[model samples]
Target: MSLSLVLTLLGAIFLLLLFRYILTPLFLSPLAHIPAAHPTSVFTPLWISYHRRGGSQALPAITRAHSLYGPIIRLGPHELSVRSQSAIHKVYIEKGGFAKPKFWADEFMSYGVRNMVSMQGGIGSKEHAGRKRDLGNVYAKSVLLGSGVLSDVAARVLRGMDEVLERIVGEEDNADAEKTGSGVMEVYNFNGAVNADIASSYIYGTDGRTNFVGDVAKRNEYFEHHGTWLKGKHGHAESQKWLEEFGVQLCGPGVSALRDEEKGGADAVVYKQLHARGLRGNDMASETLDHFIAGAEAPRTTLTYLQWELSRNPTRQARLRTELRTLPLDPTTDIPNLKALDALPFLDAVLMETLRLYTPTPGPQHRITPPEGTTIHGIFIPGSTRISASLAILHHNAEVFPEPGVWRPERWGGGDKERESLEEMRKWFWVFSKGSRGCIGKDFTVIVMKLIVAKMYSKYETEVMEDGNMEQEDKFLAGPVGERLVLRFRAVK
Candidate 1:
């Protein structure tokens, strides 16, 4: 009506908006009691979002926040970063209490489709469980040891390693007299290739999968796409399409029919299983790509670091070699008995120690607070808000893991003398995470790592030549910063 009346109404609305969006969240909301990582975090996510984009600095900053302000701190108007054991347990293992955050989809999708990592809510839960169930029997320790499928997979991987060893000796013999390993094998890419081949073979079949170990440049190219995808670098979407097509080709017509593939021959092992469980064509391919992407990074990272640690100590390497030598069969055999191979005390400790200190995926797993709203370190967090716990905080807890950053294989002991400390260490070990939604690939990865490590140490001795940027990248699925781990492997006399 009149200008004065309109102006008065507009002023009232402005004040109301201010109170609801800013003042209330800053000083009057339920989260008001929690300390803010940045003053502006009380009103907006910009403060934390900026830090997140800061790359490797984000986790350290959050760790400082947790150190300064107790276990729970507000990172944004709708987000919280939690660090206490109680909070992490309640959030992750309280019967699937929290839904995964939205960023999973932003970063982890394959050809614009939901994989197990990107899916959320009830549908996500059902799909994930179905997939896990389909592979559970296959991944079981007993099955992996005795089953023909894994035996064949193991046979192929060992054959590849035999080739790698031959090349290592050949390179040294052919090199200049002074250059024993001037051209380091740069086995990180080869390790990635072998693991990718094994994962794909298991998902598809030896016939259907990649022979990247036989083609280092092609394998490295596949990993080049991985770098672009993980960094969200330019052309990630385009690269994702290429990855999806690669996965589709790996799971073509008769892959599932192979006796060594998915136990039931469902969609064609992994692809067929997902398809049968309702992941349409490309989505099935997408999920398969998710597995390959996962198989490519974390396992390779573990193998890389394990080698790095071993290379630093010749005494430890010899001890490990002796332990590996105790195996009933040598590296060149059809395949070592999984049961006997896994029992090597020194080998297991070395792997466990590396997993503890050098976890590849040592990043925050974002989970939304559930409807019921939970308390973390006695601070109540509201429902439907983004909340997370980083593996770094838990794994590096000095109280739980003394000298946490140092790599000491002896710390993971099997004897009566160290059993007590080992128990405490297990509680803090979140490498594979823990929860109803925890990684189903834990056993598979562990077995693969053990197999690779056992085989490598048994045949050759590695020394790190140039591991530029050994620091783990600060991403959800991180590897080394430079993406190159150069090492010289010499055939054992």
Candidate 2:
């Protein structure tokens, strides 16, 4: 063939390849029928990335799209956002045909390591199930009843609070005494200290032999360093690529320290015991540690919000304190029984309400359709299409949670119809998520939250400091907006 003819043939092949790989997927894919959140949604990742970086705006934007485009809205060339409760259940619980999408893997990629939370591909589900099974008993409500782990952690938390309270009170008292001859003094880090100690104990174990609560400097260092790693622009992507290139076992120093502690060091002691007690196949130790690390910031955030809310509404705070006092406190001992604390109705109501209003880490749970395909909201979704449901949007849905922003625990504690409505709301409460992929450390979280709130309210009166910012920061996880929460606390007597 002539040179001109050969060039024309090559040009034709290039055009065909471009159309097949790029144009068709962007403009003619199965997702084309759905509404796009941005003008470029059919073509690029810019829209999603913009919302991701927008922090608090992320969920609201997705919610708007869902409202406009029905339950399932096209987010990208291959992604769909499923906002309705029925759709969420169908995709996440009943179908079980969708796998966690790559975004999570991208977002949480560590130093050449992929923990159960961020692992990708086919192996993740089996591995996660195995790991979850291994430590199930360790986190069971029944196990916590007799577990020394609970009491030991509670003691450590009380000790930490004492120190924190003493320091704050001393400062306040000194300032007050200088200004006035005689005055009452108070302070509150009640939530922060308690959450820190509880998280530390759960991760490091209760024996006092291997306690992260004791290693304050190290814990601070780890969180600070890991926080940097978590936020670096390319950290997650680079880390994931490194893991794929090198073996996951060969994680870097930061991740290695975390994993080693969970797998074999003193931190792993509690988990090892659970494993020995017939909790087979699961890696509860590592999973628990991961859960603690991933979750530590949240309870502190919740506590800060609770304190702020209570401070603003002294009557509510007083009522809660009365409720706490009415419960029998140990006459001679400092700690209350786990069952009694757990069963405190008012405390439970307050926490449930707090969780409802200020959901920690209220992000979307994303999944992709299986090879066999599936249908959502009566629309057929092809295999490999991305699907997600946002807990923030669902929790704040006006239909389910009237006056959703209001903090009213009483709404959850009324007559049959009211209680039934609250229960229905709880069924869709995605705070810890649901189904097989639900939070593994939920039991531990509840226990610690109850014990901390119970212990604090039992002994001290709390108020939000005047200068503190009570709003929550909506990051990868919702944390205290200001990064620090200072409160005023006084001895109950």
Best of the candidates, TM-score? 1
Tens digits of per-residue lDDT, candidate 2, 326-443, equal: 6775554466777877777767778887887888867677777877777766667788787888777778777878888888777677222444376678876788877766666677
- lDDT: worst 10-residue window of model 2: 245-254
Put down candidate 1 lDDT per residue, 107-202, tens digits, no spaces.
677667777777774223776676666544655667666655665676777688776677566764421112535435666677888788877777
lDDT of 1 at 381: 73
lDDT of 1 at 429: 90
Q: What residue runs in model 2 are displaced by over 4 Å at the alpha carbon?
A: 1-28, 54-57, 95-97, 106-114, 121-124, 170-193, 207-219, 233-269, 273-288, 331-333, 414-420, 467-470
Q: Cα lDDT for residue 429, model 2?
A: 78
- What TM-score would you give candidate 2 relative to the actual structure? 0.79
Candidate 1: residue pairs that collide: 256-268, 267-272, 267-273, 268-272
Candidate 2 Cα RMSD (Å): 6.4
At residue 161, candidate 2 shows an lDDT of 58
Q: Identify the candidate with maximal lDDT.
A: 1
